[model samples]
Target: MANERWNLNTTSDLTAEPGTPVGLVNQPRTAAQRLTDRPSDYGEQIVPPKPLWYLDKAGEPHSLGVNEPHQFLLFWRSNVGDKAADLDDSYYMGVTGLQGVGVAGHRVTINATGEVLQPGGESSATISGFWDKSDPDDPMWTPIEPETEYTVTVAAHNQSGEFGPDSDELTITTPAVGYDTQQLTLPPRPPNDVDFAAPLPVITTSGGGGIQLRWTTVPNVTKYEIFDNPTPGTTDGMDSSRPGLNSRDVKLGEVNQPSAGTPTVTFTTPAYTTPRRRFALKVRAVRTNSYGTAYSEFSTPLRGALPASTVAPGTPGAPTLTVSPVVGGQVKLTISPPTINASNGAPEYYAVYDGTRQVAVVSSPLGAAPHVTLQYAAAQGYSFTVAAGNSVGVSNPSSALTGTVPTPAAPGAPTAVAVTNVTTTGLAVNWTAPASANPPVTSYKVYDGSTVKATVAAPATTTNLTGYSPQTAYSIQVAAVNGTGEGSKSSPAVTGTTPAT
Candidate 1:
């Protein structure tokens, strides 16, 4: 019994050890027993290992170009040991100008998590920032001067609240600030009714019949040059390099540092003489860099006309208006213009008005049908009027036409979808009613991803889908459908496994 160990949970007879009862004195614990008695004091504290970091330009560590000298992406790999805890705490990254191994220069701290630290918070492994020399007062976490060298490093605390060692340092140099070399493309032209165009631009004649032009903005562009083809029906090829108006075109005007919102310019038209005049307009973008200025291609040409008349046109005949339903709560209004006559100045153009508000103006070389689409809310009614116009003035409004927009309730996505039953060859599914069932949901579509499995009628919440393989998993979703079309599918697809035969 000298070398035997006793279990603390069991009752042992002292007399079993022959002479143990005679002395009954305690003996020193063995080395193994002493080691097991204080387990917490033997191990080292768990702390995250230092991270290994690298700096790169667009993922290339050694090939930073002149244009990307200042821009860099910092990346690192975790240096976690077997006993180290998971990295679940906020980590800090920093960059500083370096002169020598121990020399200090400008320094800035960047949060690798892209968020401010809070107690018990975690963040992403990567973050991006830039240094600007031009604006020292700019509000940024770590602003660096251009054309300067800097070193980057990272560190983070372990779950045990111990800060790990800093990652290996990476050095980088900032590039000079300048314009991008890529050519600026032409800006998208404003929507206009010039024919076969996706967006039609709206033109309104201002006081004194001046023409105001409007268009959308282009990215990375600071200037715009407007060109006009004075001669009707002729194409004038214009670009940034050849912005000058050709023999048949004229450089109307230029806009510098266009505003962020809608861009526009106005031109004064000559006094109306006798007949009507037509003009084609186009616009191009301009960008200036250190090298020089570059231009984009000209946008699609927009056609507009100016009428000449000293007398107002005669009142237009009662327009024959037809209303047709269209998508997105809109109705198309088709107006048949009156026959051209000397009294109406040949019906140069027509104006469509919604109540007292002018909705659209359409040019008509001669009497023709002009169609306009107006947006309306559900159950909303609109009254429209048409007026013929010449260079002199607009004629009296025609008789009013009224129409009502249709209300179609499009069902929302189904909710609380779950699997009801599963068989080797078939699966059953059910869902709750959609939040919205305007016009009432007529049917429901059961989908496995994009593929439709079955169509179930309304008032029914369950459907058994067939043709599925045995011992297989299926992710299913349900969608409600009404006259407006199928609604979005339910989120968090419910998965079901079929029983094997």
Candidate 2:
């Protein structure tokens, strides 16, 4: 092929008036501009088309785009002013450099190709490629001022390395991500629209299980940042770090929620000893997934509303449930009008009190009157209280209301107790054939000295020595008893175990 240089005129007409934070205008061309080649009088008219532009990631060009991501602009024009065949589907893109623009050095950029995008090219060629800041003068280093308009022109090269001539140039503005527009600069806007809400859904469950959150949707949000702060001992349910505190300062935990529309957040809390726990949670729109994390403003704090347990009622409605003289046993209890009465049941909570301190509390459903119980054993002075469980927590114990569980008659001393030593099975056959054993000796209440060792039935005499595998010495006894009749315990127990033989 003979060496030849086809002279081609190239230009465009896109303009960025002024004070506009200039950036890539990535719009496609119009059909009219692609259909007919128009002629102009001021010489700022339509001209011949240009070649396509592609990203070449080799040892040629490299630059970060809008989001500072590793991507470049791509442009292509016709070799002949005529509509070019489907050349778009013919090529792809890469990284590094293409044409003559690339990373000149670390911070500086370089672009030297006799091309400075001017406003004269038609509205068709989409410019896409390297964008560098450092410019070096190997060939011709021309510094492109940020926010300045420049022209990019493309030319067609034949397969055998021949020029099809110059194509029309497209105009574009270059602006670093931060350069602002006049005075109304773009405030830190989330990458795209973010979905969120003030006072969003918040909740806490039994035992500080976890805090849950949910919100609205956003178009281009990648992830969500959730925050929580403890409003310890707070009576008013408000989600916030007491005023003037940094979110982190008031932070309980930060959670990452999905940006898939539904605004949901959650953070688990540690175990709780107190009857009730409370907290405040807030949400912020964020996106760490993209090159530059796009973040939306924080939503107002939303105090999670937990189901507050209500206070137990006074004066039993149902049959009086005798609290087994045992500690930690609860009983079915409820307030007067089971329904919450804003007036009387307004803030009260159900608690089993032992004169001074409260032993148990129903701390949720703040108004529901449900069964409540005394967690501790009956002390000399003990009574129940449908105490208020509110901002100030369960109110001072309810009442030492004249209540008493008649002390159980000293259980009649057990009777007819008996015992035997078995050498063959290495077992203690202790039993009581008391006449009261008709009720089926529930268990032969046995004791080693004053300490109760074992409680077995008399009918079932042979007490297996499994617990004491080796020939360990043992003392055992038995007693005959029924729900109503407890008999005298067996006399001093006989010793036996896994035989020495």
Candidate 3:
């Protein structure tokens, strides 16, 4: 097909030709017509909106104490006409720099975007990216000095990568460390007077065997530091070489300036069992102001001993004794321990007494049963008592108990039987009871050779046998009688010779 040109003037006329070549009729239009026909070309470069300002904490500007950190909050509209669809690509906020205005002035960049000129082309000063508030991590500026004025500004970038106008500067100042130099005076040290009235360095018994200490307050003192030592005179002769005279001493605690109606500060001693723990205490007063802190010299060392707790275990209950059968001339005794005092501490041990004398000491009452074995004769009786003891002291003795040694079989022969008070016609015989008598001897029988001489009641140490020939020697023997019957005669009969006139 041969190419031919068609002169179609308007879009309507060009569409009317059916067999006309589409490419020939379709031709590029002039720039002016294209510009007029196109969507009017109303688009322009986007500019970031100005940011609204606020303090990081309180909405209004506030004073910062010495060493306080400065922070701010800046927020702006990120959307532009056509760029509003791309929020992440459209805009970003930056803190330019903090400028200190006047004497002792300086400048520090808080946020930057790598631009050689100032951020947002606002200033010619150098910039930095040391801190960025938009960053979640490490989002704080370098702290400023107290008593200084600063102007903080922020800039925003649009999708075209161009920073718009800077936000209005916010002026702030950190507060000064305010105090009157003259008011910073050292407080007077506590007095060394041992007689400084009650409640001042007063020592009292604390609950659970401890000591409590209290002291009066000094005027204009903001804090009081206390020192304590086990040795007396430790605070004496302290030189400048030892800056803190009581440096060796332990610091108990500090007392801050008390509120109204509270006149004294008290320290309760820790729970301890050591009796009479002598403590040397010294107190120094301190005050702080713009001139700094001042400490007074340590007061005179006051010594006091910790008193024992007044609460004590109650008296022990009566003890019971159980005697065992005698074996080999000895008897065994088992004692039941006493009950403990519920209101106070338990006893340390028990004192076992035989009559008025303390015979043994049982260290633990709740441990093994208090078992004791003692050598005893059948005729002898024993009395026992018990008393509880503790760190404080011993308690009163419990009720007394009486026991006797047990014996088996008949009574044994009497011992130490002899003849005394010899005369011309008569002589007296003296004897003692058997050592191991089960039923206990009721009477005694005296014999002259093979003939029964006389009978006497039991426990009769002396007996007279008259009608004896003078200058004659007679053989005599004694026998013990019990409820069962008479026991064997005494061995080795004693020979008695009466003197002739």
Candidate 4:
């Protein structure tokens, strides 16, 4: 019970019999008033450790060890409580008064007893905690200065998030410059290292219909900052007044580097759009410690290379297609640009597909809708779909439009016509059916010297011409007919003559 101290149970308990020793228990306090008579005290007071020289430079005397602004003498408690095993595992050391250090306070993990190297090859017993400033919301231990007297303090933290009272204050004095043996001075350097170059970020498609950015990992980098230039090639500098680097550059987001994994950041929301979409992307490495944060210069866009979009445009909407019958057994496919949402930007082109097979890729022409004319067999069924595509990738195909070219317009003219049987009054005209008839040759018309002599139904290539003048020669021609109407007459009319009756 050596670590346990007497604490006020409550303000009302002060009224108890002076020597009663009643209502007093050594149980650890869980409330704000449990540590001492002060209502503000919550946890038990922790024992303070002796301050030791914080020597970062070799051959430096202990009296002049605080050479760097970020260096501080080591202060730690061997064990948080009497039980070294239990307290060290269950409690943490909360250090305050590390002026010029990170965010004014820090919660450092307890380190096993170690040694700090001293001058003349001598070593001092030291069990210190590592400084942590990665989380902006958490306590930050900033830089410490040399030749200054610092009032440092420490408190114990329980597993339940309760803090013990501050330990006895310790005033540690840093040696003044030009001490006995010329005190060591820290090398001149900027608080943060900004000379390193950042890796260029690459934008790629995400499996979840979003976009992902990746970059090479940098050593000692805790996180990566991503910036996008909406207008590529602009020389605008980052403006602090705005959200991103400048009026043109916007910070996409920051990704914490995992201990072991590819450096990547994925944005699932705020999908990309055109005209306002990110044209190029850059990345910078960030490192933080007790000294502060150091950032590498943002990677510049590669020369003569298109910058990756902050977010690849989302898959575009399916394109609408219209099919019309063109002359000569061809079908004209007119495509209406898909209704691209703001997130999809503008499509660069369209892909036309027949069933699952791709048939054509139609680039968007200036001031005109995309169209393609394809030869189609008359009356043959057709199924067509179109998909919109952009710089990133293609979209899902639109709904299928099913249709076929109109049946062949009127069959071709009869191939051959001749007067086979010549009679005094009438003669029989025979001809071959027209080839390339879509609906098949349905009927034919016989012409005698530019006059319609007779009409015959299809399957009967021959027709009899009656009422012709006897002993007169006649010019005979034949024409094919279909659902659309009659076709051209056979070329070069055949002549026939009848013997005198």
Candidate 5:
């Protein structure tokens, strides 16, 4: 062998310096001097002494390092803020401990070209020659060939290449073309599953909420971007652009090479707030490569939320809130007759509540009985109950029911009324609130024509029924009631359907 074939696995007792780009005078070190395996003399230019961490190979601290900005001037000034940018220029790597010996020969074999460069080539420079560590301005030149393989070797003049040995030939070549950077191009990379939150689900009167999220597992990706838009409201990430990039469509902290698939994340909401809320999401894969390759991108089509929060099977029951339901802006329910004196001939008022929220309070000074014809309005399938509140104590909530109160009845025949605007869970039934004689009509009844479908024990009109079979029809009718008793069934029947699957 021309040189010593030393398989030196033994770590060098000579400590190597750690490299951190600091008051770097912009002087560059050659790639081979990266000290990745073993620390060699890392050639650094005279930079204004600032805070710098001096370390040995393997990242061990050789000593406490605090390079204060010294009398030296800052080099190659440029815009400074978040990231350290490199200036455009050619840099050289230097040698140390050369003492009296000189680099007698040097050679670099290129992979693709198969050509070699030595001491003096038009493109390559002799990195090793008469080594001198004395001058701070000492410079060394090395050469590089594109898309090629290279094996480099250096030796001294005093010895016939018997001491220091040669390095493994690094067959330099462009990464395997068209490799799925996510798969083949590099070492086995860890998967990057971008940032994700609880998905926006299709809320249903059915109890459980729906949630869908944006996700991907990519290789070499740094940040995974997730954002959403609520169909009924606004999507989660809908606030900014999808993947939330800037004018450059480059979002910060995004990852690259995400794995395939749009995943879902679930979360629960308080049952009563109607599915009036909805959303959509976008997730992206990002990669910041050492080679500065373009970032990879992927987006998804918009998704919708399912409606929930509506009236239940029973109207005058628990879990239901009687909201005015007219949709001006936000209708807050305020109590009336502040302090009802039922004992002083004042009529007892009936109230509707939303999950303990009191919306409407109704009572007449004339001491009117509970209205059978009036229907309290609520969302389609949420639980609700009506309480006859007086000046005294409050009453227990009625059974849990979903939907609005039924309409009043006509004195004559109630005809077949058709229903529309069907949702997955509930329906709207409209009919006449039955007629009254002497005093006034209050309570009302809606039946599947056989059994009482739903009843309004207090004064109200128009009810939304929840928890119904989807796309199914039901024969419905409304009747009147008062303290007297149940009135005759309405003449005509009405029908409505639940949402189709």
Candidate 6:
């Protein structure tokens, strides 16, 4: 309703001309007398001249026919933008028209907000010449009648509700009804009568091999257009007024919202070459309507690196495995970075795997021997491998490394020893095996008075000692042996005696 309302002369400037009776009603005053009124008499101030439109290189107005869709450019200025650093302010273009005969109260007035005008240049906006019959109650946009004469005037209204003087009148006469040739397409009005500024896009890696761009979805935006600095090495100079704003940009692509209720749109680069390249990117939102496509301002530029290679790096060499001596000790795997070439590219990090599953990833930069330690059960065997990886992808795994943790201790002592026969020169002995053995017991040893007398294979608990003198007494002991070496001698040595000859 505020758009439709306007102020007009209401109070007469009539005054007594000496002989005229004072306080007379309906008395008319001269135009000169109204001009002499004090400033206080007028409640509003006049702005710039009325907005003017289309003139050719010859400075002559172009003619339009009612049968064809007609459009024209409207130019106007405000107090703003008088200086170079000033920003353009929003304003309404007030249009009023008369058809055939000039009639009171029958004229139609329409106020529409136009596109933003840049400062320090010719400020202009495209305006439609005719209105559609979409609204039965609103006749301001109704098409002109055939062969009828129409009179139109445009004025600029500031946001503060002050109207400037009207422009020179624009008059048109419709041709015969059959003269139509072209259709008129008007641009869609901005949402809520205000233009939108596009939100900036966030650039990052797509995780696998390429660059990714993400941004917030704007309401009324049907699609988004992506732009990149044409040159890979140049930074974006985002001065909107300069020709570089659009001239230097290359349109990468455009995308629509994938689905409803989605708040973000993502774009990943296609497979890229090895030795990744960098990019400077920006985005803009667009909406299409009956009038035409409307675009939000371009977002700020973002710089990011793209994937280096499309192919995965080459397989790495086998890693070396080290087993600690103590049971349950850590097993360390030292990985050497894979060799890099044109075919393999360079690896960013190394991945350590146990059999087919990945156990850990070494995030260290390439060219270093990454040491990874894992706790292993005592004497348990393991098989592991390593691989190279980068943003592009992962390489084939390296040769497998197999090993086992060192046993924490030797086997437990042998038990249950008994001497069977005693003679002048020899004796027979047997014993029960130890209960626990790391790496499994492999042999047994016999000790006579602190000297190793004999060695026997595992699972055997019997032995014969034959070097004793005829009437001598001897102390005998047995111990278990395994991969970790022999255990302590059996406790409480058995006493044996030889008979005299």
> Which has the greatest lDDT?
6
For residues 1-501, what per-residue lDDT tens digits would candidate 6 score against the true structure? 111211233334334333444443555443334334434445433233334434444554432212322443344332222211111322222122211111111111222311222222233444444453345466344443456655555544433233444555556554443322212222222222111133222212222234566776766667877777746665546658643365467777888856878867787544333244455677777777654766766676676554454456788789886433423467777886666555665666688888887788875434556788887777777788998887779888889988776656788888888887888888888998888665578899988888888899978889898888898988889989887788888889998678899
Q: Count the backbone clashes (under 3 Å) in each candidate.
A: 9, 60, 0, 11, 84, 6
TM-score of 2: 0.32
**Number of the predicted model whose TM-score against the real structure is largest:** 2
In candidate 2, position 386 carries an lDDT of 44
Model 1 bad stretches (over 4 Å): 1-275, 278-311, 314-323, 411-444, 447-467, 471-501
The best-first sequence of candidates by lDDT reads: 6, 1, 3, 4, 2, 5
Write the residue-wise lDDT of candidate 3 on 1-501 in tens digits: 222222223222233344654543456554334334434333432234443343234344221212222332223322232222122322232122211110111122233411122233222232222344555564654444556656655455432333444555556554454233233443455533322233322112212243455676666667877677767754555546556764457677776867766766665444433334567777777877655777877777777765432344445555554434444356565655444434544455677788988777765424245666666676567787777666666777777777665554667788777988888888888887888665667889998898878999877756998997779798888899886588988888999688988
State the lDDT of candidate 1 residue by residue for 168-260, as single tens digits. 555666656533433332233332321322222222222123355555566666677766676866564544554444666677777775566
Instruction: State the lDDT of candidate 2 residue by residue for 1-501, as single tens digits.
Output: 122111122122233533433444335343244224333322321222234433234422212223112222433433232432343333323111223221111111113343323232222222333343244344343444555555555443322223333434445566555332211222233223223333322222222224334455444454555555655334544437444345343544444545465544444433322224444555555555335555566666654444343442222122133443322223334443123332322333455554556555654443233555443323333455545454434344433444443322212334444344545434454343554332244555666556666666545654543344456566765555555456565555565455665
Q: Tell me the TM-score of model 6.
A: 0.27
lDDT of each: 0.56, 0.40, 0.54, 0.52, 0.37, 0.57
- What is the RMSD of candidate 4? 24.4
Q: List the residue pairs that clash in candidate 1.
A: 70-175, 191-199, 191-200, 191-201, 192-199, 192-200, 192-201, 314-344, 409-438
Q: Model 2 misses residue 294 by how many Å?
A: 13
Residue 189 displacement in candidate 4 (angstroms): 53
Better of 2 and 5 by lDDT: 2
What C-alpha lDDT, on a 0 to 100 scale, does residue 94 get in candidate 4? Answer: 20
lDDT of 1 at 80: 36
Model 3: worst 10 consecutive residues (lDDT sum): 98-107
Please give the ranking of all candidate structures by TM-score, highest first, separated by commas: 2, 1, 6, 3, 4, 5
TM-score of each: 0.29, 0.32, 0.25, 0.24, 0.24, 0.27
Stretches of candidate 4 off by over 4 Å are 1-323, 326-329, 376-380, 405-501
